[model samples]
Structure formats: structure tokens, C-alpha cells
Target chain A: MTLHIVSKSPYSSSALADCLRTCGNGDAIVLIEDGVYAAQTGSEKLQDFAGKAVFCLRADAEARGVAVTATVDEIDEARWVALCTEYRPIVSWFK
Target chain B: MKFTLVVYGAPHASEGAASALRFARALLEAGHSLYRVFFYGDGVHNGSALAAPPQDEQDLLGQWQRLQQAHNLDLVVCIAAAQRRGLLSESEASRLEKSAANLATGFTLAGLGQLAEAAAVCERVVTFGG
Candidate 1:
């Protein structure tokens, strides 16, 4: 099974970075909640994973009034469910 | 299939804990079995016995207890992290001669080996943090 990571924590950024370092070129990184902040458009850290599918929550983005500039797709609750069902990813919710 | 949840955030500091709780409920409702819930790093604070939120706020400890009892969940608090944060069980508290043990019931102290075991046994190990 492909491990799905919702990189949402600032603390786990290093760990997330560590995780992505081993990306087999088929994994995805969904930046939800506070994780959207990590995708500051042209951030070098986020650049590596841009080739993979990157997602952010639309509600969270609007709440923060920050436009996600990365190659990030938007996900709502229904879409979230769909992704989970389709991928059955091992979700890592980072704060 | 079996899954293990690693909670890495405090109960109130962020939504990580609440989200994890919600996901656990969803997983159970969807007919999935949980092997364990490992509390690591700042996540151990969620199991502290001294936390007292406002009256309206969800009693996190109570919620964890309820889920644990109902699901017979194996809750493990990382001993290294707990000690660093001053969270101890009754025995550890007494052995260390601390004022008290803040670890709640339905949870036990364990090491990183538990994490490795979870990784090996469970089909997926989900982590909630930040």
C-alpha cells in the first residue's frame, strides 16, 4: 500500500522531509491544515515533491487567506473521502 | 486488516489530536480493526492526567478513555517522551519519587520497539501530528 502523508505539523517538517527523501517516485504529499504553509509557492523544500500529487484543503486555505501557489490540488471533505477510499493510504497527520 | 495510529500532537494545541480521534472513529465505523495507538513526542501530553480544559471543551482524556474502553485499544505512551515531559505512571512516579503520575488509565509505557512492531504487524500505520 502507498503511504499517504497529510503533512500538517510544523514539528514533523524535518521528519516529512526525511520521508520524502525516500520517495520512490510514486508517492504523494497532501498538505492539509497547517501543512499548507509549507507550500509557499516557490519553497525549495516543496519543489522536490511537486512532481508528485500535492493537495491542500480549500476551506483551510480560505480561512488562512493564503493562496496556495504550489502545484497543489484542492480537496474537500467528500474528495478527502474519495482519496482515502481510492488510495487506502497510510495517512500521517502531522501538526 | 490492522492499523496503528501514532498521535504526535497535544490534545488542545492543534487539531491533530481531534482529527486523529475522528479518523479512528471513522476507521472503526468503517469496520477496520485498530491494533494500537502510540503516543509519541508531544503527543504524550494528551494522556496527561492534569489537563483540565474548559467545561464546554471536549474532555480529551475522557474521550480517549471512552474510545479505548469501547475498542479495547492498546494505548502506549513513549517512555522517553513521557519522562522528558514529566508524564509518569503510578509506578514510575513512585519510583522516581515524583509528585504524581499523569498518565491516565487504558495506556501503558513502552519504547520505540512498539513502533517498529506496529509497522511490521499493521497494514498501515497512520500518524497524526503538528
Candidate 2:
């Protein structure tokens, strides 16, 4: 499984949408940095990632004072590291 | 495991370059072979030989050069990206009629194909960006 990391905000960049378009089954998505913004409540982008293994970095969410919705799991740094190990070719999508 | 690192942020303006440098060091320490360090987008700025950071600050460009020298690392700057950012190799500068070249020592301007080749062979491809 490839760990696709998105670090750009959907509001400002198309990295998230582009990443989703190329991502396949069994692939995991980790939202970090400004990417956590996409997991916020009422975001239209969240719907596209439903049923996928989606995670957001808690530190980024808290730092931005964003309340992530239920669709995504909030992960700490340790979990992030674990995901890196569990996945291969961690791909980062940025603007 | 062999790895390829894609860096897409400027050295002085973002944490991406520094973070990538640290990660590269750790990978080498762990005995993993690095296939290449591909600089894309603003990451090409890391290859600017004209960078003159304060004496008190860590010289990131110099550190990268030293690392490349020690490991015989393949440091590649995307030629298209470098051209857009005014980072020219000696030949590119002459071809473009630029007065001087600013690509740092130990770095070569190459096509995106290098990145693809690295990805094809490396066990993992990690990216660092702003």
C-alpha cells in the first residue's frame, strides 16, 4: 500500500483532488500541514474520500484550530511514523 | 533499502530542505542506500552557489555538498524547474546567454526522467515540501 501524504490546502491548491484521482484501492491517505483543512466539517472534498483509510495529523489540526470531521481518523506523530512503516513509497502531494 | 528523496521547497524559506537533509542523514546512518536526491520546483534553490547565510547559521547548501562528496550521492536538479527559477548550470548559462551560473557544486541539471528512474529502482520515494 502506498501512503499518499497531502500537505496542501484544498482551498488554495489542487493537490488533494489530484492525489485522490490517482490513488487506488488499499492506498492510505494522510493529511498533514495545511492538508488537515480538508478534513474539516462541511468540506465537499471529504465526500470523495469516504470508505478509504483516511487520517489527519492531530498536531496540524490543533495548530490550525480546526475541528476535523468524523470521516477521518486523527493521528499523532507516532501513528504517522507507524503508517510510514506500514506503507511503501510514501508519496507527498504539494503545490 | 534503497530510497529516493524528492525535495520541493526552498532551503532558506522553508523547513522542507532541512527536514529532507536530516532524513537523508538518518537513512544513510541506518545503512540504506540512497538512489538520488531530486530537487524540483522551489527545491532547485538549494543548488544556488550564491547563497551566503550568516556565519552563525548552518550552511545548508554547503552541508548538502559535503554529504554528496562523502557519499558520492546523485544530486539532480530538474532542468525545467531550475530554468524557471534562474538556476543555470555552466553550460545552460552559456546557452542562455546568462552572465554567470549559480548551480551549486556537486549538483547536475537533468530532466525529470532522473526522478522517474530513481522511483522505478528505489525501495521507497519520500518527498519533502513546503
Candidate 3:
């Protein structure tokens, strides 16, 4: 298992693309920092990975003021730690 | 489990390197081992030996050097990217007729095969970028 952290905005960075191409099931993608931009409501790119678990860091989302109502989970730093510890993922792609 | 860290951001440009460094330290603290840290694209800048930060500030380059020294970490900078960016080693600098070379002490110049090998060897491959 592995967790991919997408730290760049979706429109410009190929982070999401790399994650989709290389990541397998039982993996996760966390949108943090500028990556939260990809989690906004109605993100077309996110549609493809609807089956994968998508998470956004609450701190980054609140700081960036990105409004979203997607079916994704908003996770805090504590949860982030928990996710890293729990999954112990095999790969994390950031862009 | 062993982990591989790929850095695709330059030092002092964004929070990517700092964040990755912090996460690497944390992973080590958690008793995890790092297989390698691959620097590619703009990330090759992290190995530039010319960086000189203010005395009062935390020199990130020095931080990486210290971290690698302490942990015996594998710091691999892409040869293609480094050459393109003019980040030459002593030998490359001399061969290319450059006056100086400043790639960091701990980092090595390797090919993409290192990245592929890292993927094959490591249990986790985490990337840090812009």
C-alpha cells in the first residue's frame, strides 16, 4: 500500500496524472498546499479517480479559501499522521 | 518499510523541498528507512553547491548535507537534469571548461535508471514538488 500526496494545483501540474498512471488500488491521494485546487467542486479531472480515496488537507484548504462540496474527505494534520501510519503506502507522487 | 523520496522542486523556490525534508526526518524518526532521494527536473537545483544563505537563516543545503551525513542517505541528482541546468561536478566542470562546480557533497549524479531501480527496491516512493 502507498499514499500519493499531490502538492500542486491540478490545472498546471501533472501530479494527478502521475498518481493515476502509477498508483494501484489500496492507495490514496492527499491534496495539500496548492494541490487543494484540484479538489474544488466539479473538478473534471477528479472524476476519473472517483473510485480512489481522495483527501484534502484541511489546513491547506482553509488557507487557500477553496470551496468544495465534492465527495472527498477533508482531513486534518492528525488524520494525516494516522493515514501515513496506517497505510504505509508504497509510493507518493507530488508535483 | 523502505521509502524513496523524489524531489521535483528547487531549494528556496517553494515549500516543496522543506516539506520533503521534514517528512523525511519524520519518516526516519518513525523508524522507517529511506531508499533514496531522487532529484529531477527543477529538483536538481537542490544539489547546487553555490547556495549561500544568510548566517541567521537555516541553510537548507546544509540541512540536506547534515541529514545525509547523519543517516547515510542516498541523494541522487539526475545527470540529464543536472547537465541541462549546468550543475556540474568537479570532473564535469573541468571537462566542460567551466570555472567552478558546486554540486553538494552528498548528492550523486545518476540516470533515470536509478529512479526505476528505486521503485523496484523501495516499498514506498514519495515525491515532493511544486
Q: Pick the candidate with the highest lDDT.
A: 2
lDDT of 3 at B92: 86
Q: Candidate 1, residues B1-130: lDDT per residue as tens digits?
A: 5778888888888777776776677777777788999999899988887888999988888888899999899999999999999999999999999987888888899999999999889876777875
- Of the two candidates 1 and 3, the one with more favorable DockQ, higher being better, is 1
In the range A1-95, model 2's lDDT, one tens digit per residue, is 88999888999999999999989999999998788999998888889888799999897799899999988999876566567667986988887
Q: Once model 3 is optimally superposed onto the true structure by TM-score, how far is the C-alpha of residue B129 displaced, in angstroms?
A: 2.4
**Cα-based TM-score, every candidate:** 0.73, 0.69, 0.73
lDDT of each: 0.75, 0.89, 0.82
Question: What residue pairs are clashing in model 1?
Answer: A8-A94, A8-A95, A9-A94, A9-A95, A93-B127, A93-B129, A94-B129, A95-B129, A95-B130
Task: Decide which is better by lDDT, 1 or 3.
Answer: 3
lDDT of 2 by residue, B1-130 (tens): 7889999989877767875786688778767788899999999999999999999998999999999999999999999999999999999999999999999899999999999999899878889886
Predicted candidate 3 versus true structure: per-residue lDDT over B40-103, tens digit per residue = 8989999988888889976888999999999999999999999999899998889889998988
- What are the runs in model 1 whose C-alpha is more than 4 Å off? A1-4, A8-25, A36-95
Estimate the lDDT of model 2.
0.89
Candidates 1 and 2: which is better by lDDT? 2
Docking class of 1: acceptable
